[model samples]
Target: MARELLPGQSPELLKALHILTRDGALNADSLRKLKQVNHLVRLLAPAIEDVLARFGDPVLVDCGAGKSYLGFVLHELFLRPAGKGSLHAVEARPELVAAAEALAARLGADRMRFERAAIDAAAPPARVHLVTALHACDTATDDALALAVRHGADHVAVVPCCQAEVARQLGEAAAPAPLLAPLFEHPWHRREFGSHLTNVVRALALRASGYAVTVTELAGWEHSLKNELILGRKVRASDRAAEDRLLGLCAAAGIRPKIVRLLFPAGAPAP
Candidate 1:
């Protein structure tokens, strides 16, 4: 059962996080959850290391921290060992925040802190190195991205969950191209198409705001249905060409994603 814990992760910590059973055995669901976080941490290693090297004390913020599992695991596997970085988990739930803070205290994770705040309202450190949101439902993910941009974060990694706005809008939307209506003409297709389209808009929005983005899978479909991973690295202040593409894409779809309105104000200059 000790092997059920991730390397460098203490059994006590995993048990506290409820990722490991009381007896230290990992159920299938727990193992899948661990795998997802493991892959994300590995994928984010280079970015974290680069920030630590340059900033000396990098600040990493995790929004919509359900159960704060990612925050705990990331702190244990990355920040605790690095000794020059801190992680702030922003979660609206008072219970989760309290639990995470209590766990941090137990582990002597002095660098870890939990704040009770919504994704959109949370204020991160002045100089944020990285921002992460795992499985932030619907528009909450957009709020996290907006927070990152406002703070001028160096990197952003998010695994969005439950994209429903675009899908709901599509129910009443008439495709700009009549031939394209089949993409979302039915209820099932609309949900699926809306999720895909929402991610595309988000990526373009990031690119327009100066991030070089890569969209890929977070983990296998079997591990989680909400598996789309969007990684962004800040490259410059802005990309006007990308902004044009993003705006044009929204116009064509007749739907403005939350990211579009969040990142791009009406007639506002691109950042």
Candidate 2:
């Protein structure tokens, strides 16, 4: 009897992706990796369908694309079948970008392209339909969100990792809200509270910039510690209430993150 794979899931592509061994065997680690990305693809299916239904040809970007695994999987599961859009993988490392480009060619994924860019400097495609960042560390996730907002992207999804920037600032800054100072006065509490606050601020910032945000778990804790997924869909021009909330949160917390600076530089409105 032949081994069974998911429907329309190509073993050859999986082998090329190293998700499966050359002889088509799935290792323990590879299985875990595939499961994470596969689940994200499933979560994003509705957004893909919505963009395809609304637009003739869409452009999707993956920011801080490490090896472009998510990019390739997304293209394979969505763009390739539709044959109507492109997946642009943005990575800072030249070597990873080169390798991903070669892999795309080998897989005959002509529509998937690679670009070398820092998350903050990533250029927008002609029109951006979707933007995603997986495990982008520290403030890089903020850069990805800024990119999406600048382009007014139809959808945004990010799984942030190691939000150290806020934690570091929390240690140095005095709490404007005296009652809440206890939340981060200790080292352990500072780390945990800072991480939680970072995500909340991000969600509020997205809302301020006209996106309806959803925060959820990306996967089980066993799969990855960085499992928090922030998803957003464009809904309006902007929400001043959300903007005020974001401003108040930052002021009370006594921390101004990169996203706040990018979106509201010098206390001016977003462009």
lDDT by candidate, in order shown: 0.83, 0.84
- In model 2, which residue pairs have backbone atoms overlapping below 3 Å? none
Candidate with top TM-score is: 2
lDDT string, candidate 2, 89-173, tens digits: 8899999999999999888888898889897877767579999998888899999999999887899999999898788877877
Candidate 2 residue 84 Cα shift, in angstroms, is 0.9
Instruction: Please identify model 2 stretches exceeding 4 Å from their true place.
Output: 1-6, 221-223, 268-271
Tens-digit per-residue lDDT, 1-271, candidate 1: 5554567878777778776677777888777656666677788888887788788888999999978888888788878888879998899999888877887888898888788999888877877889999889899999999988889899999999988998887776655456667788889998998999988989988999999999988664554679888999999999999999888766666677788878887833222
Model 1 clash pairs are none
What TM-score fits each model?
Answer: 0.92, 0.94
TM-score of 2: 0.94
| lDDT for position 214 in model 2 | 93
True-structure lDDT of candidate 2: 0.84
